[model samples]
Structures are given as structure tokens and as C-alpha cells.
Target chain A: MSPRSDTPSSPSIDESRRGLDLGSDRRFLAALILLGGTYVSLLLAMVAADLFYTTPGHLWHALGSPEIRYAIRLSLLSCTLTTLLSLWVAVPIGYLMARFEFPGRAFLDALLDIPIVLPPLVIGLSLLILFQTAPLRALETVFPVTYAVPSVILAQFMVACAFAVRTLRTTFAQINPRQEQVAMTLGCNRAQAFWRVVLPAARPGILTAATLAWARALGEFGPILVFSGATRMKTEVLPTTVFLELSVGRLEAAVAVSLLMMGSAVVALLLVRTWSGTGLAGVSSLRNG
Target chain B: MISLRHITIQAGSFNLRDLSMEIPTGSHTALMGRTGSGKTTLLEGICGLRSIRSGSIWIGDREVTNLPPGQRGIGLVPQDGALFDHLTVRQHLEFALEVRGWALERRETRSQELAEWLGLTSLMDRLPAGMSGGERQRVALGRALAFHPPVLCLDEPLSALDDQTRGEIVAVLTEIRNRTGITILHITHNRSEAERLADRILHLRDGRLES
Candidate 1:
């Protein structure tokens, strides 16, 4: 080909390529949208189905029911308690696991994962058996645990805490270790450095761990069912309320309860997201004071 | 005076074996070494961040070999200026005093003095994340110097800076050295930094000092 005839200006070449690029880009976008949209659509569809099946009246009626009201109160109480307890146990374990290297560290790490990997029902069964041991049996006489309110919190904590610990371990690991070292050199002892430097820096992670623990505790069913049992106005929680309603062929009640739990979850998530976004509202006072 | 007598530091598989050196009081020294030459391990041993396997570390006349880092009366400015992200410049300067149980009024005065000295008075309320590299480095220096420790250890402190910023920091460091008369052990790869700031320079090759 002749150079003048065959060769084109760079702008002309870019213009031609732009035409093809637009079509390809549109197709690529469509494929990605379809793939991601499919999963989101499924979720939307299920939620829509729940909305379609239950009315405002059904939610009100479920709320009016004495059993569900008890379930709501109990669920709120136990989930908060479970979250508090989980954070207490998880933070120390997470810090130690992330910051130190010792003999049997690997073994201890594997042991923590057993709750996450084990079947929930097995955890419930294990707890039931644990309570039967001589020491726990002796303590049981002082306070009833199995098939009681305490059992509800215990069951939720067993699984929820493992999740909290895992999240916190990752959270603490991501923070700079140099900060703590610097703190120690600044005349703060090891514990003081952790309290002031390490913990304050790990605010986001603590929020995440607490949220995960709360959410996991809210949805827990298998362990609660196995150990606490579904009783009316006593050991009954929201999950059990759903199970009891469904077993008795009250689909509307179950659906209403489900929506209630979903709303609570959304509210909890939003609260945390807002709190975290706001820099935890006076970090300087907390850290320096 | 600071002294390390027959010190040994074991860092995993690498070891700085039986090294010994002396840093006279009120003198700033620069230590230079090739990569992976155990400069950091040796620095950590002196600051009590890492425990020495054998031998003694003495600050003045007291044997401080067994003391914790907090009790050793030393200050550290690691590379990258590890300032706490959640604290403001004022908080950073006041941290050591706060932890040491200084009264609130005393801490405020000390932080104000440091802010004036380091030219950080304009950044008192600003968090570390909002600061420039040079600014953060200055804050780190203020934090190290806040409690007025007798010894200061700098680990590759000026390696992460542009030339102009480096020059400014070098000037600030020189001012600090002259004014405070505190002993400093600065680790760096830049010969000019050593020439410009240090009273004496030492080199580390294969874990032993070459004066």
C-alpha cells in the first residue's frame, strides 16, 4: 500500500477505535451488571416475597402476641449480653494471638476455630454435656443454666465470640506494632501502651467485631434450639419464636418475625456505620485522657 | 555515658554476635551499615526494645541490662515517624508526660514548650493523618524528646524525605542536638546527614563496629 493512502492520522485511528471500544464497553458492562444483578435480584425477590405475604396488620398482630413480645425482649437482652461478653473474651485473645509468637501458638489458633467450623447443633450438644460434668453440675444447683435464660446467652456467646475473636485478630494484626513500641519507650508500661495506643487505634476493628458478634447472636438458632429449647414466655427467643410459629403452621407470624429481625439487623448495621464514619465522636479525649 | 559490654542480640536466624561499643554522654553519633547488617537489632538492644542475650547495658553508672523499655529512660524515633493516628500534635507531644503521671498543668506547659521549639505550634489540634511527612517527622521528634530522656535512638529517621525536606529536618535535628545536649545514636545511609549532624561517625560491617 502507498504510505499516503494506507496510513492515517493518529486522531483518525483513535476515532475509529473509539467506535469499537464503546460497543465493547457496553457489552462488558451488561455482562457484569447481569452477573452481579442476578444475585442481588434473588435477595430482592425473597424480601419482596416476604413483604407480599405479610401485611402491616400481620406485623402488628405478631407484636400483639404475648409469646413474641417475650421473645423480642429476651432476644434484645441476650444479644446485648452476648455481644458484651464476646467482646470481653475476644479482645484479649485477639491481641495476644496477633501480637505474640510463642510455643503452641499454632495449636491455640486451631482450637479457636473449632466453634466456627463445628456444627451449631454439636456446640449445643457439647454444652449440654459440659454442664453434666461434676464441676458444672455443682454450679448448676446454684443457678439453673441448661434450658434457661442463661443457656440462651451462653449458646449465642459460644458461636458469636469465635467470630468476634477472628475479626479482632485480623483488626489488631492490621494496626502498626511500631506504635506500641513507641509508646513503651515514651514511659508507658506495656499494659498502659496497649490500653492507650493499641486499643484506641483498633476502634474500627472493635466495632466490626462487636457488630459481627451481635448479628451472629441474633440469627443463632441451632445451638439455642438444642440447648435452651423453645419454651413459651421463658427461654423463647426470636429465632425460637420463628421456629415455633413455623412448626405450628403459622407462616404469617414467622414471616412477620423474620421481617422484624431483618429490620433490627439493618438498624444495627446503620448505627455502627454511622458511628464509625464519625470517628467515634471524640477520639482525642479518649486517647489522651 | 552509655556503654554496651560484650552485647549479643539474636534476631531469628541472624545474629549480631558479641558486639561492643561506647557512646560518650552529650555527643551525637551516626551509625552507618549496609542492608541487613543488623543495625536495627543493635539499636533495639541499646534501647531495651530487644533483650540482649548476654552482657550488660549501662546508662551512666547504673546497669540497665534487665530494665524494661519503659523504665530505661530512653526515647526512640523509628523510621516512618510512627505517630499515633488518633492523636493530635499536642496529644503526641504530651503523651510521655501523661503516662509518667505529670500533672495536667505541667504537661500542658511541656507540650507548649515543645510545640514552640519544634515549630509545631500551628498544628496543635491537627491529627497526624492530616500532616505532611516533614511535619509528622517533627511530631515524632517532639514525642521522643517530650519526656526529656537522656538518650535518643533514631532508626533511619531521615531516609524517607525529599532533599529540601531532608535539609529542613537536618537543621531541626542540629538545633535539637545543640540545645538539648542529649545523647543521640542516629542510623542512616546518607553520609552527608552524618557529616552535617554527628560529632563522630561509626560503621557496622558483619555485626561489628568499625570506627
Candidate 2:
């Protein structure tokens, strides 16, 4: 009888198993693609529906409205201001949170995140209540805060600043503390090291934080609705424009304004990527040494 | 001179108790230790980067026990250089001088001299990311030495380079020692390196020092 041929070469066994593994991998990948493709198709369908629902004529008419024009101008100005103010506050708070170990630091960290986790309308209500208090209420007589133009910016800032602070904190945390320590050893004082070494390293992160704040401020609705009251040509931002148009039963105009807001958001996100050449949220990526 | 008298440092649950050491001026001493022997902790304590629970640290006859890192007048080259990524080599060399409020002309002159001495004159405008391991290490050394502090501390500065680059850096280090009488506290685990560069060797095991 021939030598037992049941135990073939080990290489043939491995080759057959390898072929089976390849088939299994293909099936696994196919399942992943099928699941992921469904979500992507849903997103595409939503965008397609938004485009198909409104015409260029409606968009042009919405743009032609003097009230909408004024809303656009005010939205731009307030969002820019909110972004600048948010950065000014965020950088120092972020640095302290990232670098220091003080008493009640964990408590403070959690407390700072309240704006992020709180219900949107509650923030606006809280602001309204805050302005009604003694000192602010006294000041309100001289400088009106509640239900005013400043109230619009203030409401946007309440939510936008929390986002800016979170971004900046992560940015500062990613940077190596060694460079700051080395700077001190090389004759830089604490403040100088932060300004020269830490700040420069965090420049990309600052830009990202500012972009996030601007975007958040632009889309802010519930706070502005409750705090500033969406008066046409007074406190109407893009989101409020959509709300006001829908309230008047002009679905076409509401869709038009929503499309415009979407366009602006896309442009802003593109600009960030174009300017930094880093993908979204490249916080502390540029000078990570 | 660099002196540590009865120093006890507590890092987490590990304790380095009553460790004492002395290095004379213009001498190179190597510190040898196992992976977790607290060599870096002791080095940080000397440089004022970490707190020591007890005892005193003195540098060049002046007690720097409570001084801040910048006020200590000691230069430290941490592992792998720790060079600033955003700055060019020239900027790094003049960093200390610039921070101390030196005039533009003076800073330029000193940085130029240092660049030439470190064989990095051609690479002045390059950032740390664009350089070789040896070149970056040279820049690090030049940066630390630019301000001319009395003491220089090296924390495994040569361990990251290849064999030939290591040899080149060793030669450069030997020259640096001969030219300037700066006290150097070199940290290394390699016995051959310790024998080659250090005048005296000190070993650390379980946070205690042995000659």
C-alpha cells in the first residue's frame, strides 16, 4: 500500500485554511459596509430632500427680504464678538485646568461643564433670572441687557464658551510639559514660558477653539429665543430666521433659510480645513514636540 | 560644586531616603541606576523641578534649596533633547538670552558663536523635526550651554543615538568638558559609557547610593 496519503503536506493544509480565512474576511467587510452605507445614505437623502423641497426663487426671495438681510449682518457681528470673547476667557481657564493642581479642581472641572450638559432653554432662563438679580438688575436700568441686542450675544456666549473651554483644555493637555519646564531651566519665567512656549504650541488649538465657538454661536436658537425674543430685524439670527419663517406658516421660506445656514456652516468648516491644512480638531497637532 | 545633603524625596509610594552626594567643580560624575531607581527623581530634585521633603541642595557654594528653577543657574538637557518644535535651532540657542532681556545684537552674536562651536552653523534655520538624532542632540546641548550656567546636567542624552553618532557625541562632550570647566552630572546605565566619560561613578539601587 502507498504511504498514508491522508496526512498531506502541511503547506496544503495552510493554503486551504488561508483561502477560507479570506472568504470570512470578505463577508465581515461586506457586513460592515452594508451597515455603514445605510447611515451615509440616510444623510445624503436628508440633504437631497432639503435641496428638492425649495427652489432658487424661494432662496433669492428670502435673501431679498430686508429683515433677513439685517438678521444676517447682526448674526455675523455677534458671532464674531462671541468668538473673540470666548477665546479670551478660554485660554487662561484651559491653561489653569491643564497645568495646575489646586484644591477642589475636580469639582471646578465638573462645574464648568454645566453649560454643555444643561438643557438649552434653561441656560437662557438662567440668564434671564441672573439679570433680574440685584446688581445686574440695578445695572440693567442704565444698560438694558434682557430682551435686547446684547442679550443675543450673551445667550450665544453662554453655550459657545463651554465648547471653547473644553477644546482649549484638551489642546493644552496634549502639549508636553517638558518644554515649559525646559524653558524655565533655560531662564524663562513661568509667564514668559507660557507666552513664548506654550501659547505658540497652542496656536492651532486656539484657531480650532475659535472656529467651534463661532459655529456654535451662529446656530444658537433656544437661548436667543428665550432670552432675546426673536423679533424680526432685531434679534433674529439664522436659526431664529428659520423659526420666525416657520411660525408665519411659510414653509418654503423656512426651508430657504435652513439651506442658507447649512451653506454657511459648510463654508466655515471648509475654511478651517483650508487655512490649517489639518483635519477637523487638530488641536495641539502642529507643535506637539 | 553640587551638593545634596541628607535629601529625602517621596514620589508616590516609593521613597528615596537620606540620599547624599557631592560633585566638585569641573568634574564629570555619572549616576548609574536600574530602571526604577529614582535617578530621574533625584536629578529633578537637584534642578528644582521636583520637591525634596528634607535636606538641602547647594550649587557652587550657594544654597538653592528654595530657589525656583530659573533662579538656580543650572542647565539641564533632558532625555531625547526635549527641543522646542516650533522654534528653529538659532532661536533655541538664544532662548535663554532672549528671556533674560538681552539686546538683539548681543543675542545674535552669542547664538552665532554657539552655532559655530556646535557644528550647527549651516543648520541654524532648521527646526528640530528636520534634523538627525545627533544633530538634534547637538542643538539641545548648544541651547543648554548658550547661557553658560556653572552646572550642566545630562539625562541619558546619548542613549538614543546609533553607535557612530554616539561616538561623535561622546567626542563632542569630551571637548565641551575640556573647553569649559562646567560641572556635569551625567546619568547613564551603560557601564562602558560611565567608565569612558565620568571621573567618578556612583551607583543607585533601591533609592540608596553606593560608590
> Quick one: best DockQ, which candidate?
2
Evaluated against the true structure, the overall lDDT of model 2 is 0.85
| Docking category of candidate 1 | acceptable
What is the interface RMSD, in angstroms, for predicted model 1? 6.1
- Tens-place lDDT per residue, model 2, B1-211, is 9999999998777899999999999999999999889998899889887789999999988999999898898888876687887799999999999988889999999999999888999999997765788898898899999889899999998888899999989998999999999999999999999999999999999989999
User: TM-scores, in order shown?
Assistant: 0.91, 0.90
Position B150, candidate 2: lDDT:
92
Q: What fraction of the reference interface contacts is present in each model, in order?
A: 0.67, 0.58
The lowest-lDDT stretch of 10 consecutive residues in candidate 1 chain A is: A1-10
Checking candidate 1 for backbone clashes, the offending pairs are: none
For candidate 1, give the lDDT of residue A174: 58
Task: Estimate, for each residue in A64-152, the C-alpha lDDT of model 1 and write its tens digit.
Answer: 99999999999999999999999999999998888877778889999999999999999999999999999999998999999999999
For residue A208, what is the lDDT in candidate 1? 74
Error of 1 at B87 (Å): 1.9
